[model samples]
Target: MDTQDIARPRLSEEDWLAAAYEMLTESGVEAVKVMPLAKRLGVSRTSFYWHFTDREELLEAMVRRWEERNTGNLVARTEAYAENIAEAMFNLFDCWIDPDLFDARLDLAIRNWARNDSNLQAQLDQADTRREHAMTNMFLRFGYQKQDALIRARTMIYTQIGYISMQVHESKEYRISLMPGWIEVFTGSRPTQRDLDRFLARHG
Candidate 1:
């Protein structure tokens, strides 16, 4: 291994993963190329191969990291909420819908990559499951039965994707804020400041 390769081992796995996505957010999927990524880390090319087999493997690792992140956020946020539908649902949406919270570029890159790779499709499905499961639990708080919750969760997941899937030229902040009103139409209750505060006071 090169001396730089030895130094590369000092960086935590999370640090490396974050650097990869930070690059992705800056330049798109192509930014994560092995040689360039190694160079970006001030390490040798062999350093990357030591941690991952190849560029494709590293991309998959990145995908896995993002999937766990969204899944973990969903699980943690859902468990923290009180038995209030509107408040819980708003919290749930905030997890994925926030502009600064999630990197929309990450999903856009994966969706683009999926057009040429079947494997990426599976990773996309995993992320979808995470969101659906989390939102389903929120629906349960809103008085929906398991099956009904599952259906509603699926809808919520799609609606969320559609919202985020807007063109890069569109306003992300505006898109994130637009969903709550429609959510009220779908769920029959708009979350209010008082309701959210009560739920937070109980659950927070």
Candidate 2:
């Protein structure tokens, strides 16, 4: 190896996790083994031991990172203050449209991983419940009754889940066109032109 290659910055845990996440998306959970990751990083397998105890540990770290980043961001957006339910729901549309904020690819990859593992499925279940509760709280804060809020929250979340699972393809313009109707269905109130304008400004 070149001296310059030997002198490259040492890999960190985040480096490994980032590579693992990429492998998870491009390949699958099964492809996230240590040797492959090390190969992908152009490092020795022994280097992995410096950051993680084993493959399982690295997988756990990946899940934790996903939960903190994706799920946490969703909840934060759901709880962001809005002048009304319409605006609050629009805030959440940010999550759907913004890959940096809520990685739909990673989310779908993890869900596919959970299919055969009961333990991972349990974790996914917990995340789903937490996210639903956050949406419900948003509706409740907007003065929706408890029952109505819960139902609307489920509708919004489940619809998104189906969209991801089905791998539905639509142009941004097409999806944006449907947002006002979606907001009406989920919030029971039509978004004014201002609401549509604000959402378009950010996501259009």
Best by lDDT: 2
Q: Which tens-of-lDDT digit does each residue in 55-122 have in candidate 2?
A: 99999998998898789999999988788888898899888778788988899999999998899999
Candidate topping TM-score: 2
Q: What is the TM-score (0 to 1) of candidate 2?
A: 0.91
Point out where model 1 deviates above 4 Å. Answer: 1-12, 26-31, 97-102, 145-151, 167-182, 197-204
Off by over 4 Å in 2: 1-7
Backbone clash numbers for all candidates listed? 0, 0
Per-residue CA lDDT of model 1 for 1-204, tens digit only, reads 678666535655665677788787677776678677767788777656556777777777877766666556666666665557776765665565554445566666667666667877876777778777877777786678999889877876666577556743445456445545755765767767675565345333
TM-score of each: 0.72, 0.91
